[model samples]
Target: MSLVVTTNVAGMNSQRALSIADRQLTTSLERLSSGSRINRAADDASNLAISEGLRAQIGGFRVALRNTQDGISVLQTAEGALTETQGILHRMRDLSVQAANAGSLDDDARGNLQSEIGQLRNELDRIAGTTSFNGRKLLDGGYRTVFHVGADAGHTIAVDLGRGTSAAALGVDGIDVTGPGRYGPGAVTLSTAAAPGTAAVLTIAAAGGSAGFSGGTGGVSAYTDLDGTISVGGRSFDLASVRYDTAADTDGNGTRDAADLLAQLNRAAIVALGLTSPPFSSPTPGTLAFAVAEPLPGHTGTAGAPLSASAADLARSTPTFTAAGGASRALTAIDAAIERISTVRGDLGAVQNRLEHNIAKLGVALDNTAASDSRIRDTDMATEMTAFTRTQILSQAGTAMLAQAHAAPQGVLKLLV
Candidate 1:
């Protein structure tokens, strides 16, 4: 089996040694240049898969972090608007207090005070309409915008800072684009219809609540499921249910009657005005139906249509001022608006806090992802360099021995000679 002339073991050993050396050198070059052992999929399929996943997560976390910062900016802007709005409310409250000192004032004095109060209200509306950040209105309506973190995997949060949709429009919806100087009273007045008894439906679209004419045994109870309080005049209405448009027959009939509707409103106003004590008395069984009195023949023409007051105005006109006697029914509307602002602010605060927590958690996630990717693909330069040096020396020694193997055939040629 030992054929010295034909068979060459040194050549075979040399070739095998050279192949091993070339493999070591290629790995060293890869580690040094690319800084990764897993440049190709065949290197380590499982580890490559894991590293890619971690890298993707790291990229996503970076975007999420930026989004968190954006959320913070939005919150700060909203907070600023709320602070200003709070100041405006305080001023309005003080004016309402001053207006209530009827003993020290005549009709003219009270009217002048009302004009100033009206002006303050108008100013608030102006501020609310104009204040904005990043092209987004912060105080006016349509500020309750929803933010989605991602598709199904992420959560949805609100970014807009206006009072809830309900209070902003006073149960109205959608954006108010007219921008200041348009809103006359806090309440949108429905002008007299073109024709009488033509059925002109004036609607106040209830937002974030269920308010309807409940003709059932239960009297009228307009509910707000969201967490907050709304004061209409001096009466504080608490919303505990999220449902809106629940019918609590304000008209008193098993069926709805528009005239009775106003009467019910007047009653509620009286309660809000603090004319009636809390836990309002239930309507007597089979009570007289609501009747609309005839309009006054003529008023001593005043600038604001001051007509002769009537018996109905007597109950409804009672001041429902707060314990400090600073609150009024007119002021109650402002209080409702203020409460809504605070509730929205609270909601924004909650979202900001949650996002901040998420930002911290995402930071940790990004760090861990980077570490995992490094472990999977990064090479130890010192270890690779040492192996490369050993391979270089072995390859050179094998090349010299291969030359000696080539000369082994020459010995057989000399014997034959």
Candidate 2:
């Protein structure tokens, strides 16, 4: 090698090595301090991309876990309400059985049983109406939703609680369990002389029949004109719009008979005039009895005033246990209602089990995904420390060698001297 003053080649080589060593040392220190192998895109581009994708999946799994938990809670709430409803049904069933024994029970004893049943039915309805989860009704026959149960879109579980558990929904709303029971008091008889725009005379009577109205002397005439508007409660209906059953001309009187008129009045549209229950019950083929004892559902009006009932409420008014034959019919109805409730409860249980399984699956997925991300992006302390030591040693050695190379230029001066 030539000795020169202008440039010491040995020193330049040592400086270059030192620079490279310092850079490696810095990278090693950063990895050790941060505990990450890939702190930026420059560290490992492809691995960084893979790590980010795994992170997204992890986040999605966390949120989906929460959603699954919420779904389970909603189902639990609905199931709890159904449990209460089942208890109420069981009690009502016991009453029906007791009332069925007409030979052993008198009218008063059966009446007591019927009273309790009516109260139970009311409570059942209240539960169905009020049960909710997060302000969403769970038992009103409209609960349906999806829970995200996986880390990806379109991975979901659907939950649906069937129709409802109300007394009406269960087909036990009007169970009487008493033979020949009068429709509870506060019903008005419509007069044959009732004309449109004239307030129908409201008479309180204890009519007797298989279903509350007896063939009695006081009743409406079949030929009474019903082709105009009549007001009930605070609403009006065009009576001419009433759809009389074309097939119900029982009297063959060349015109619609009282039975046809009664059928029209009981039509869902007319009954929806705001009463809590159907307003009209027939005592005979020609007589229409109106019930004004209670305000319409959600209505707070005084008794005896005209009101309306929804079609749903009307369907709930089927008489039960009012006579020997009625009691037999009620047993069948109660059995069917019980079966329906059992089916709903079974569905809820199945959904709960599915949710629990989904949670387990999510946990496993989260663990495996996290491990994969760690492998791609996290530092291995043992391996990184070894690299750090090697770079540190090279840095020190390079510095000493650079000093020796700088001294080589002085030797060239000595030769010149």
Candidate 3:
């Protein structure tokens, strides 16, 4: 195994050493320059996978934070509009209180007060219609709602006061009584209980209580405890008494009472009962009674105006105010609108808070993931420098030994000479 060249064995050894040194130097140079241990998948596949995953998470976090900011912006805009709307409602309420006092206001004064109410209603409608943030209307009253009074199995009447001035006033027409049985053919049963044979008579004929039927020619002389005159369809009838019989069978079960008949009658009346004026007012400590009146002019204008509205127009006899008398109703509607705004704001606040919390959590998560990625891919400069210096020295030594090893092979040439 010995060679003639004394340094041949050393030459091969030095060459192998040089190759190892060159490889180490190249690796150190790459790490130092690139600041990464995993320059390629072959360098470290596991670390490459982990590093890429961390990068994707960082990108998603940044995008999510941006989205949270956008949501907050929209919520803030809606909140601003709601705050202004609340002020408007408060102003309307104050005006209502001013108008409610009768002692200080004459008919003219009350009429003027109603004019102001009309203006306020217009303004509220304008605000509701126009107030929008980012092209979305928040105070427009369609958001959250509650139904009362007129509820049925299939259809329910939801009073939407937010339809601006259209819903401002509701008019109940006078009962157009053409003849008997305007609603339908049969013994019209008015009862105090839910019985079919309830012996309740029409005490006060509502002017617009029935459709296609004429008001019956009867007066307080027909009944008792009624002392008011009501007009319907151009006809007037005096009020009579309201009697609740326990034997009235409104349910058709042979037994009738005040509660059942009243329910049935009111339910039936609600659907088609007419009066160009307000329906019969329930007398104190008495049951429900229909106001009877003879036929008159086909139309007497709007129905039972609210007491506040009627009171406003007493002096004129035919009080006509351009502004409608649905301010109370409007107040209710505006309140509902405000509640809707608040509900949306509350939801937005919750979302914003959650986003903030998520952002904080994401920050922590990003930090941990970055740390893990760094451990796998980041260069250790000190370690790299140490290896680099060692490799440099070994390469230099190998070159010197190569020269000496070549001289030994030259000695073989000398021997041949």
lDDT of model number 1: 0.53
lDDT of each: 0.53, 0.68, 0.47
- Model 2, poorest ten-residue lDDT window? 206-215
State the lDDT of candidate 2 residue by residue for 99-152, as single tens digits.
888889888998899899889989998999999988999898888888888889
Model 3 root-mean-square deviation: 14.3
TM of each candidate vs. truth: 0.60, 0.68, 0.55
The best candidate in terms of TM-score: 2
- lDDT score, candidate 2: 0.68
lDDT digits (tens) for residues 161-238 of candidate 1: 544232236321111112221111221111222253332221222232323222222443332232323333323543
- Candidate 2 positional error at 381, Å: 1.8
lDDT of 1 at 337: 63
Total backbone collisions, model 3: 54
> Candidate 3's residue-wise lDDT over 1-417, tens digit each?
545754478789878888888888898899999999889898889879989987776666566555555555555665565566556556655655565454575667656755665665566566656765467564565433322111123221122223221113111011111122122211122223223332223332223342111122332111123333333223344333233222144566533333443444444333332322334333322233233232112223233211111211211132111112233333444456456545655765665576566567657766786788788889989988898899899889988887887776775676677
Of the pair 2 and 3, which is ahead by TM-score? 2
Order of the predicted models by TM-score, top scorer first? 2, 1, 3
Point out where model 1 deviates above 4 Å.
1-7, 102-120, 131-134, 144-152, 158-327, 407-417
> Candidate 1, after superposition: displacement of residue 100 in Å?
3.5
When superposed on Cα atoms, how far off is each prediction in RMSD? Answer: 11.6, 11.0, 14.3
